[model samples]
Target: MVAIPQRTKGIEVTRADDATTTEDFRRQRIAEAAQRARAEAEARRAAADAGNPPRPREINGRDGPEPVRYGDWEVGGLATDF
Candidate 1:
C-alpha cells in the first residue's frame, strides 16, 4: 500500500485542530449573542413598565405625598402615618 507524505499528514492534523477551534469560537459567539438578547429583552420590558408615570390618587384634596388616611396608612412612599 502507498504511504501518505509526512507533510500531508501534518497538514491534515492541523486542519482538524483548526476546525475544532473555529467551532468552539462560533458556539461561544452564539451563546454570547443569546445572553445579550435576553438582557436586552429584560431591559425593554422594564423600560416599558417604567414608561408611563403612575397617576396619583387624591383623597380629601390631598396630593401624592400625603397619605389619605393619617392613621396607619401607607402609599408608595414610607408611612408617615402614625
Candidate 2:
C-alpha cells in the first residue's frame, strides 16, 4: 500500500512541473496604466495654454491683475510674475 504525504504551511513548494507565466502578465498591466496617465496630463496642458491669456482684474481704479493657468489649474490675483 502507498501513503500520500500531507501538505503543511511554511513548507517550500517547488514549481518543477508545468511552467507558470504570471510575472509577464503583471509587468504588462503596470506598463499600460503608466502610459494612460501620461497621455491625460499632456492633453490637459495643451488645453490650458491654447486660449488667449486671461485678462487681469481691475483693482480700485488701477490695472487688473492677470490670472495664471497651469495645466488645468488656475491662480488669480498673484503679485509675483510668472
Candidate 3:
C-alpha cells in the first residue's frame, strides 16, 4: 500500500494586511467608477469646444445608436444605460 501525504505543498495563506475587506473593496470600486465618469464627461466637453462632436458609442453590435427594444415598445436609439 502507498502512504499519502498529510499536508499539501505550496498552499498559500493570505496575511491579514494583504487582505481587503468587502467594504474597502466596494469603496474602491465606486471611486474608480466615478473617476471614469468624470473623465468621459471632460473629454466630451473638450470635443464639443473643439467643434468635433464625439461619435456615438457602439451599441447593439452596430457602429451607431440603434433602436432599443423594451418588451413590446421600441425605445429611443441612444441606449446609454447598457
- Candidate 2 — which residues are off by over 4 angstroms? 1-20, 52-82
Give per-model TM-scores.
Answer: 0.43, 0.39, 0.39
In model 1, the runs with Cα more than 4 Å from the true position are 1-14, 52-82
TM-score of 3: 0.39
Can you write out model 2's per-residue Cα lDDT over 1-82, one digit (the tens) per residue? 2444433342332442211333444567778998999999998888887875876765553233333433322336444434
Model 2 error, position 70 (Å): 14
Per-residue lDDT of 1-82 in model 3, one digit per residue for the tens?
3443332133232444423554466678789999999999999988888997666766555334343553322235543444
- lDDT for each of the candidates? 0.63, 0.52, 0.57
Q: List the residue pairs that clash in candidate 1.
A: none
Which residue ranges in model 3 land beyond 4 Å of their true spot?
1-20, 52-82
Stronger candidate by lDDT (2 vs 3): 3
Write the number of the candidate with greater lDDT, choosing between 1 and 3: 1
Residue 73, candidate 2: how far off, in angstroms?
Answer: 23
Candidate 3 Cα lDDT to native: 0.57
